[model samples]
Target: MSFVKALIATWHLSILIMFHLSRMRDLKSFYLGYIKRHCQQDFPKQLSYNRFVERQTSVGVYLLLFLNLRCLGPCTGISFIDSTPLRACHIKRAHQHRSLKGWAQTGKSTLGWFYGFKLHLVINDRGEIITFRITHGATDDREPLKSEAFTNKLFGKLVADRGYISQDLFERLFIDDIHMITKRKRNMKNSLMHLHDKVLLRKRALIESVNDQLKNICQIEHTRHRSINNFCSNLLAGLIAYQALEKKPSLDLEHVVSTLKRA
Candidate 1:
């Protein structure tokens, strides 16, 4: 393909893949039913199944990253941070898995131990993704918050779970004008928090809802990945698909505050 033709093909194919994923279609059905049967009318030619997958996988990761960055919504100063497990394979198959051998690792979550990577996300109260990072399952949750690249543009309050509770991390973000709010561990001394902040903490479920939609609706998590490049591509595409969603879970700040005041 010529340079221009390749570029156009990539653009069209990327959109088609994302659209299919949003509708919960696995790649096989997407290629066979949509691209093979229908897409030729729009493209100069139709690629065989293997060739299409090869071309799509060969496309640069930066293209998907750029698309993801573009899909991010504006920062609302109140952000929720969390991570979810992306298991590469079932526990029974972990020993036999070679595709993600060196890259994926065993990690623990609330659900128990699993073998996979961790998807860390920072989203605003509006349920729009602010930024995200993927780390090994064993990596500390608070480690990404220390990166300037991840938190540079982030300001205001960040609410998270107890996993992110660290005095040093708190102070570091504080220095950058980002207030970190997390539930005090039971063993820690009580710290007074404003009612509004407490309410926002309860509303952190918005981010959890986003995670569910990304995995279940956008089809981010699967055990069938064959290559790290395609894995990353699928993940980035899923995130972009979620970003294109018309409606997202959000908190009504005014209503929350009013209800608290009435109490």
Candidate 2:
């Protein structure tokens, strides 16, 4: 009986160690080496040691997503935009922490004040993330739309928030031939939305649900870093890790359509 108990304990420990190794093992040797160094020196035992580094190698994940997008044949005709907070630390330590360098800041979220950055994610109708940008808390969601990051994207219907609305942005996107859908501000006079526009506008909430799944189910916003560089590294890593799951792309549009029809 004693031997059997000891064997079971050994098996469980081995399985836990293997799971960590499997997640981190495919990471590039250089990143692995970096994590190994940190684990031996700076990393706290409480941080899950090498597992922390394995989880933050998000660049690797992006490379894969970029490739998967290439495999999708053509760009989908629809896309959605949303922003979420990526807190690096508690708000109480916002100023005291000098570690995140330029990569972190205090951002106002729907959840209230948080100390960290904002991640603007643009995903296509097919539920594939087409582009992403990490900005300081002060960066506006509309600011990135005009940049060259989206310059070549010519023909999709862009659905975003009122925060992204402006005559300049609307005209620019119009010139590029992309249709825009956004709710009007309360104070704006003569604002009217077509029935279809109202229906499409309601779908914007789907992106918010995607953000929730990323943070909650996939654990993207759980930061355990003190340095500025590692914070960025970890942020990117979580996103990439989420992307790696693209081997099984997220829900299909047909499923979403079916659920909506039933509702």
Q: What is the C-alpha lDDT of each candidate?
A: 0.82, 0.61
What is the C-alpha lDDT profile of model 2 across 1-263, one tens digit per residue?
97754443333232222323344433334334554454444322223446545433333344344344543223476777788888877899887766675667777876888887888877776555667777888777787888866535536678888888898888888888777788878987767665555565767776787687566544556555645544554444445445445442333567556656765
What are the clashing pairs of model 1?
none
- The number of the candidate with the highest TM-score is 1
lDDT of 1 at 237: 74
Evaluated with lDDT, which candidate comes out highest?
A: 1
Name the runs in model 2 displaced over 4 angstroms. Answer: 1-74, 244-263
TM-score to true structure, per model: 0.93, 0.67
Worst lDDT window (10 residues) for model 2?
12-21
Residue 12 lDDT (model 1): 48
